[model samples]
Target: MSARRSARRDLRRLSGVALTSLWLTSLGLPAVFSAPVSAGAAGSWVGDAPSVRLYTPGREVVSQPFLPPGTPMSAEITSVSWRFTPPPGSARLETRLCHPQRCLWLATPRGQSRALAGLAATGPFVMRFRLPESARPSAPLRIEGLQLIVNYH
Candidate 1:
């Protein structure tokens, strides 16, 4: 009877792992357990879009129609820079990037107690980073945008 119970427990554990892998694969994310995650030692840029692709070395591109809120975006970003021009009189803008195991967030009008308003026509909002080595084509990550408002403004 003890042997039978042990076998049953092992079967249940295996079933759970199989189910998790299937779900991730269905979503197009790399198998989380298949390998160790690492960032690329050599800098590289991977563009984030409906179909993510690696960009040419040292080339930079800006996205149009800044991202909307609650979406996750991922890119194999390299050492580079980018500029953003929010609409005039618009509130603050928020941006974020993430990988399977990590996330980074940035907000505009940084460090000032006063709320940011009336954005200029253009400004430096560069994102520079090396792509994660373990990155595999996952469900196309998304960049989410949020507009912040200040009572004083």
Candidate 2:
């Protein structure tokens, strides 16, 4: 009888974990359940926060990887998704796409106050933060974890 009860308890625990993973996947956030939660060090970017505070009117290069001269990529960004914390306190998130020439630079706005209303643009955005102040300054807003969801052909 004792052995049977122990087995039953173990089964329930496993079941719960499975259910949780499934639920997260359904929400399009499988990173929480996967072992490799992040691409940066230690599976997350919580240790570092944005240092730039003044939102400026210049273009700040975020991530632009150079291929092996002749490398090819047919990736068309369908959408993007990001998760952050130490979060905006009371401020919201906005998406800014720096469309320069033929390059699209994705940028997240950083702010120090709750009134970051002028720091972002209101539109159909995901995983992108847009700050209104368009001047080049130091880092301000800090993001914990950001994930960009893309569909490749």
Candidate 3:
């Protein structure tokens, strides 16, 4: 009798899951157990650890220009964020994202992320950085990473 009761409990739980899945599917949503959609085609792109080193003070360091592979030209960039550790000092670091036509300055202090409203990813972007005179030339400034978050139709 106990064994039969346990089986019924298990069956009830399974049926509950199936019913939820069916309801979600009816609403044009993916089931909970379904495979996740791929973000490569249209989703956020995070580029990590470019790890650029800046030697000269006040001289601009430009990274090798790049973009998320398979990203279409028509894709619109909704926002962008940067992550890095600033060289230890009062020296302020300047950063920018540049394409062929223009550049957008990332003006957040302490390496915080910022948003770019409806900025189209027209082409590949290169990271440009410059340190103030207060920066110690003896110590190279390391830009840890950069992340580009994009959304598209």
Candidate 4:
């Protein structure tokens, strides 16, 4: 009882704002959550978790298996600002965001091009990028600045 009181007091002092609400779970645990008073830009979606760099390969003459899988599909994406950087000798790349049987490829104009079209159903999905058999990277590839606008339903 006193601990919950102390927690509430601490949060109040820390937030420096009016107390919204406090929730106590069946397990007798008090949790604090906050909501932004002002909304972000129109048509924006931030995932509960950030997108992560899948893998960074080292220099060697062997094939890396592939990316395992990503978080289950939670929302539909509307627009994307995505970029992938491959090292020297890396070209003729084919990238895909795939379901087990069906897949969607990244539509990029820089190298070869394929456009991403349609929605990916919610389920397990893996991203696979293939380099031409004759091509190899001397350094690891870096995925940078990926921002997605999502359709939340």
List, in order, the clash count of every candidate structure.
4, 16, 0, 1
Give lDDT tens digits, candidate 2, residues 54-73. Answer: 23333232422211121123
True lDDT of residue 74, candidate 1: 30
TM-score of candidate 4 on Cα atoms, chains taken together: 0.35
Cα error, candidate 3, residue 65 (Å): 2.4
Q: Highest lDDT among the candidates is held by which one?
A: 3
Q: Please, what are the lDDT tens digits per residue for candidate 3 over residues 1-153?
A: 699999999999989999999999999999868565555345566544366778877899987666676766666666556555555563677788775666778776333333444566545677788987666766676766555444442
Reference-based TM-score of each model: 0.23, 0.27, 0.57, 0.35
lDDT of each: 0.35, 0.36, 0.66, 0.40
Q: State in Å the error of residue 11, model 2.
A: 51
Each model's Cα RMSD: 19.8, 16.5, 11.3, 12.7
Who is ahead in TM-score, 1 or 3? 3
Candidate 1 per-residue C-alpha lDDT over 1-153 given as tens digits, one digit per residue, 9 for 90 to 100: 699999999999989989998999999986677554343322222222321222332222233322323211332222222233334443333433322233235444222222122222112122322223353323323322322211111
Q: What order do you get sorting by TM-score, best first?
A: 3, 4, 2, 1
RMSD of 4: 12.7
| Higher-scoring candidate on lDDT, 1 or 2 | 2
TM-score-wise, the better of 1 and 2 is 2
Off by over 4 Å in 1: 1-41, 46-84, 109-153
Model 3 RMSD vs true structure: 11.3
In model 1, what are the clashing residue pairs, if there are any? 38-133, 68-145, 72-142, 73-142
Which residue pairs in model 3 clash with each other?
none
